[model samples]
Target: MATPGTLVLAGTPIGRVEDASPRLARELAEADVVAAEDTRRLKRLTTELGVTVGGRIVSYFEGNESQRTPALLEELEAGRRVLLVTDAGMPSVSDPGYRLVAAAVAADVPVTTVPGPSAVLAALAVSGLPVDRFCFEGFLPRKQGERARRLAALAGEERTMVFFEAPHRTEAALAAMAEAWGDDRAAAVCRELTKTHEEVRRGPLAELAAWASDGVRGEVTVVVAGAGPEPGVAADDDSLRAAVDEREAAGMTRKEAIVEVARSAGVPRRVVYNLVHSKGPR
Candidate 1:
């Protein structure tokens, strides 16, 4: 019996086609089965590389990933080398290859990766911010309330945060970030990375928010400075009570308002509520 073939997750260039590794070209031409997130894009890539795919080409994207994983795994089990490629960057990083990779691992199939261009690292490197302790947040939630809640949770995070956002919603997201993270905090908005119109704008969150209000085009990534040292404010009973009252007056339910104030003030929500109703809402 022939040994089972390996499952290869290959990375494609984020923008420039010349950035594709030679090994990626060879693997694309030689694999027994080629699974691509966008087959049309793969065809274009193969045309650029001047290589003809000798293997079977299948579409594997977000919509079909769940249904396609089993089929791909069967080919790998049958000793067919399966190469997975995404439209840009590595497959499975906020892309459509995780299900297949998980299936391959669960079936005891060997899997490997071909490192290639990554917008995440590229944006971080050029952001003029500290990279040693940075975190990738992928993308923010789309809904206004959900996005605000997500940002609220990160208010106390110390690691610099990176995020991807659509051009259309960049202004709203940045504005919401400013409201949650403070207007004066520093950030960078890196756009059209690795492309001809690449641009990086760095400034206070409020300023970026205002700039984005007019609009921004192309792909975008944002890097934000982490929450700086805690402010020298006392989180005493009186202060906590005052904050809860402020939020409650602004429209949040009493419970919701307490949590919001506690998070922003860097104190426990329960501690604030206890201070408010020590003998139960007089």
Candidate 2:
């Protein structure tokens, strides 16, 4: 009988390589096999850290993930420790690793992690938005109509929203967000975070949209303020839905309209939300 090897999901620095942990270095040097999102990036990181990888290096990116997962899982079942690292951040975050992790878990292989810097948390921390609760909406749909529908669906999302966008699409994303979340809504655009030229532009969605219109660069993370209801507004079942529609048409977030309507009508936010969004007869 042999012990099943452990699978390590290691986190890498989003930008500044110095943020890589000592534990990551140790794991990189000692693992029996390494599955990297970008083998080239992993090479650079190892060179910078002055650590020579003793493991069998394997490419495991989105393109080859489905094909490569089984090979890695075989190593795990063979009692060979496998380490997984993405180009940046933890694996499985809009990145590779989920498939392999799932396979390993299903096989009852031990799974562990090496925590490191994360752009999501770093951006959220500096976003200046309410961080008590937040959701990570990884890259939006590229098409205009699809993106619009996605943003519209989240119109009632009150928890601060965090999104990753390409530099080229930053302007469009901001513009869509402004239309959906309202131009007056506060937001922060974080670019090249933790690296030289890192910039955090905080302002209303309209302002950010205009600023990005000139073009932006590097990795982009956009954080938007959550919608809250206005102080005075009324709500009945029909009125609630109507109120949200009116405010949304006027560029207020659906959640903001709901909150305002509930407060004025002396109703709970959830009750108001159900009335506004429920499809069946109320």
Candidate 3:
């Protein structure tokens, strides 16, 4: 019986060839099968790193991952270590490699990772946003309605939010964020991290959107400050009720709305509930 092999999810450098780690080079040279999102890019990376891959290289991207996964699994079952590398950063993070990893685990094949550079982490580290707690939102939907709905759901997310955006869509995405999360919401647009011409712009969502309007370039990652304090805590009862009303309009029940309102306002639920019941719409 052939011993089952290991599946390694290796991270490639997002930019700058030197960012490639020695361990990554070693893995590329040692793996029995190298599955790459873009074989051309993989070749370029190997050449730049001065490392020759000692294995068969195959394309394993979105278009053919389904058909290719079974074949890759066969190699693993036959005791061939399979190394998965995306074009940039880590695999399965808004990239290919997730399905194979899931399959490997199901077959009891050992799966490990060679952690390296990540654009998401790189953007976050340099964005200067609060990172004690944050969520990686990957990419927004291309459809405007779907994108708006997605942003709406995150409207109340208190944790810092991270997102990837293509250079072309960067401006539009920022505009949509401004509309959904409030134009005054704090945000940073990180472009081309770790590469020459890298730029990070920090300001309110509206300001960032307007700045990108002139046509920004390069890969983009956006970090937006979470929703700030709930609306109008210092205002009268009518204002508190209005905040709850907005949440309820978004499909939250009265109790749920009250809880969220109070949490955001940093006040007790009882205070919000009292005001909500006493308020008359102005």
Candidate 4:
């Protein structure tokens, strides 16, 4: 039986090709097959790094990820060293590499990663928010209703939240965040990270939304402070159900509504859940 091959998930520079590491260049040149999210971007990266890759380069992007994962898996099972690189940051991170990596792992093929630049961490560091406990939310839903529900569920999250947004949608996203999380909620907008035009703006959510109204360009990362400790508001049973009902009416699942109410009311989730289900004394 032939030995299974290795699957290497190499992180690419989020911006500024100079950030590309020497090991990345070496791996790019040595891989048996190079799977890139954007082959053209990969070419540019290789050119900038002054490295030439002799391996076969294949396109593995979002549209083709499902269709191409099986073929990539075959390469791994055939004992070929396959390296995956996304357009920026790391593969499988709001990028196309998870399907192949998961397939490779399921088949017992060795999977490794070459850590490189990450927008999530970079934004978190520059956002000046509490990073000890933070959650990478990646990108929120594009649709207004879906995005609102998603944000509603996160209303009580106590950990710092990081989100990625497209240049065009940034203003709308900031507005939605301000509406859901509160106008005065502290947050930061990091744009064109690591690039020459890099900019980071820190202020309340409403302020950031207003600033973005003028238009934002380049890759954007948003970091928002988590909710402060529960207000322990002296809310009543009717008030709790009312809160849950309002969220449920806004497209959030009943369970999600319960959790949100519990969080914002400083009550236990189980208590809120039981109250809604009529299991607890009203």
lDDT of all predictions: 0.86, 0.86, 0.87, 0.88
Ranking under lDDT, best-scoring first?
A: 4, 3, 2, 1
What is the number of residue pairs that collide in model 3? 0
| Deviating ranges (above 4 Å) for candidate 4 | 229-282
TM-score-better candidate, 1 vs 4: 4
Q: Is candidate 3 or candidate 4 better by lDDT?
A: 4
Clashes of each: 0, 1, 0, 0
- The C-alpha stretches of model 2 lying farther than 4 A from their native spots are 229-282
**Structure candidate 1, residue pairs in collision:** none
Off by over 4 Å in 3: 229-282
Model 3 RMSD in Å is 9.0
Mind giving the per-residue lDDT tens digits that candidate 1 earns over 58-169?
9999999999999999999899999999999999988999999899899889999988999889988998766779888888999999999999999988777999999999
lDDT of 2: 0.86
What TM-score quantifies how close candidate 4 is to the native fold? 0.81
TM-score of structure candidate 3: 0.81
lDDT of 1 at 110: 96
What residue runs in model 1 are displaced by over 4 Å at the alpha carbon? Answer: 229-282
Clashing pairs in 2: 229-260
